[model samples]
Target: MALRPLFASLWRLLCSLKLAIVLAAAVTLLGIGGSLVMHFNPGVFGDLDRMILGRWWSTAGSAAPLLSWWVPVGALLLALLCLNTLCCFLDWARRIRYRWRKGGEYLIHLGFVLVLIAYFWGSLAGFRSEGNRLFVGQTLALPSLPGHFLRLEAFEPIFAENGRPVDMLSTVALLHGDNLLARQIVRTNTPLTWKGLAVFPGSFGRTVEGFAVHIAGVGRTSFSPGAELSLPDGLRLRVLNFLSDARRLAGGRVARGSSELGRPAFELELNHPDGPSWRGWYLLAEGPPSALTEAGLLLRPVEPLYRPYSILTINDDPGAALALTGGLAMLAGVLLALVSFYYKRGRGDRPEVW
Candidate 1:
């Protein structure tokens, strides 16, 4: 048979409830296949920094990156959705013999289809995000898209110990241009929708947190290799490796090992330390001298402030809305078919004897 005939028949076959199960199964299998890879490999998280949410299916190793490959996989998944809709439309079109009952059912489903189409178009084109990195009372233009900009009313980041984030840094932003739409706060679960964009709260950035440091090595201390230090300026510096002939922080007046007592800090030997070996020792707020002198070096621990968070991933897929609408309509259409079939049979619209 011709391709059109075959497709039409296929769609007719698929219009049955069985086709929904098949599509759901296919989707489940796809998810399972992707989940297996992630379960086996622990190192994929490292690449997540470079990934765009959906690219985690294929492990790119050292190659050109998964987006070069996995994005097409995602595209294919979207294409399958078209098959799902064809079945629904075919089921409605098949009931040509009945008008009012079937037609009303069809109308409800057509409304559902409209919703689905809207979702599909909007999802593919609609962009969503929760935005702003500005401090309180500071204003920053927001953009749901490239041309859009939102002015910030405020942003806050409340945190816990070890720099673990407790809540999203809330930023109140306004529409940059004329009053097309008002502004609001977007948090996790709650999203602010304006024009075709829905901005949801994703997470907080490290830029809101204070400074931190790790002491990888103690130059001339009697302490072990693993120690952490926090600098006054708030820069978290790490010692990649130990340098030889590092200055020692030993004082006979107190004790040779007392550097671990009143002061639990590390003495840093600068790479540019000149003669007599200039070195600086920084202690915790509880330790010894605010600044200790060792050898003949004026060494100070360096602290750096937090870096700003720049980007957020926004998703606008037109298919989601369509799928939701189609789903609801499909349900109504199926129920109507069942009820109409039962009522007609019970009422004896035609006599059984021939």
Candidate 2:
């Protein structure tokens, strides 16, 4: 018999629009209090709760706290839904009295409720972030979650003349395992996405390339530092030359772009004759051709290549729908109650009947 009254009271509370409003206000106040506690105490916000009239708030009260925040959020949403149902009741009551104005007021409130629910749904699910940092030769670990691995092939940054550190770029060599994945030159605005996760370009310069030493001198030599050449048909050519922007007497002089690589043409050995063989002195990618012993040679700019990076995920929820439904309902109630008790309250079409 005692249980029956208690159940009845619980039902009445759940069916009350007033209760929903109070809780909503309480949730907001709690949020502010939480912020204040975190701001003032700094330490206690981690886990603390004081008096009740003060709007009781607690953390990790359950057996396991850190593992769940969803429970509390759900409870709040449920309370909001009860309020929505109450609003629906108000509309039903007003409609029986042919109060269209009151109904319209309630509908306006419903729209915002839907929006809130969507937000919650969006918040509770489908979101995650995880990745690792690595040097050029090193590989990135695949996330613990289901997804492919994105390897850093090379990372380069473009800087302004003043040198304040600007954009970062990564030449990524992706991988699934021993097998290669996608390879792309990634920079700002460029992202590599797969399995619902996205890899954006982060800061750069932590790689094997960072360890490279620059060597420049006035001389043409066999092979500047780069990958040694390999040929399909037969023999291969090693890059045999490079100098700054300069030339010398038949005896010797070297010129590379605008800067002299210390000295000019000294000596060079042709590494290959085909493919990368003596192309042009002013080439872009594989540098220019070599003129040593009239053998086919290639000139290459010694640019140390490397890769580095990190990864960020944006994810999707089901309960959010119910909360939205409830919120909309509650809003409708407030509007109907407001209009029926005021503006429409005095309308001539309004039945004198209470």
Candidate 3:
């Protein structure tokens, strides 16, 4: 009974419009500060996450050297703002007289509340995206979902005139053990979405696929397209041309065309890195990538080079549905509020309709 006056005072303070305005202004200022901090110190937040939360399944904290301190502060202020909005809404409802004109005001408040709820829900339950690079016949295990993996079947790169890459595509299959659940052709703009999980084709980078040479300490080095090698024996090797698709011309001649993945071949040149003193072409795919000697070194091509794989980003948003519903509800509430305000003003019942 003694706490009744204290609760009433707290409720009145929370329901104050001035408090809501102040919170809103603070949120806006914090947003501006965040943008500025991100612009100046781009990797500050990422570094903070890595340092405080570790690499995989990362979270963020205030250990960052720069401006990441605003995150928790902003979040707290936003939560308080939501509470203030809710309090104001309840206060408005309690003060309103039962009338049709008051419907618009109720709707407006409800919409704002729904929008806030959606954002809060998303912040709490939304998914952080995961990225992976997959090659042909390679399987990637899903981190978030157990007993699920995606396999890369084929990756094709479409080239325009003069061998300029235009678009890339990947055929991927999601499977649980031997059971194939879904097969999708993921492209740059076309994403594969299944079971609330969306898979998007990201960027691409070269991978040394086939002929790999195990040089002592240096894991596995392959003769890929645009590859340069500096051997420990003071010799340099450079690949001149790699033809994954080539056509045999008239007499003992191998030439590449604009179309088709024919016989794979490579034209290489070995030289001293310091100066272009000794340089000779080693036609590997034509003869033997292994049995070659221009630098007097037994640098052999152990395997073949495969097509570059595409980077894929997988995302799942649990609160997406809630966010969408809340957004639509908010919009409808705004429209209802406007209708009520206009209808009341037309009848000249009140000059200012809150």
TM-score order of candidates, top first = 3, 1, 2
The TM-score that candidate 1 achieves is 0.45
Per-residue lDDT of model 1, residues 129-243, tens digit only: 4333444455444432544455445455556898876655445454545553556665566555544445555555533122233233333312223333333333332232222
Estimate, for each residue in 232-330, the C-alpha lDDT of model 2 and write its tens digit. 345454434444334543543334434323323222333453445443332333333435323433233344333333332212123345555767666
Whole-model alpha-carbon lDDT for candidate 1: 0.46
Give the TM-score comparing model 3 with the true structure, all chains together: 0.61
Q: Which candidate has the top score in lDDT?
A: 3
lDDT of each: 0.46, 0.47, 0.67
Better of 1 and 3 by lDDT: 3
Off by over 4 Å in 2: 1-15, 40-108, 119-124, 130-161, 165-205, 210-354
- Candidate 1 residue 26 Cα shift, in angstroms, is 3.4
Quote the positional error of residue 26 for candidate 2 in Å: 1.8
**Number of the candidate with higher TM-score, 1 or 3:** 3
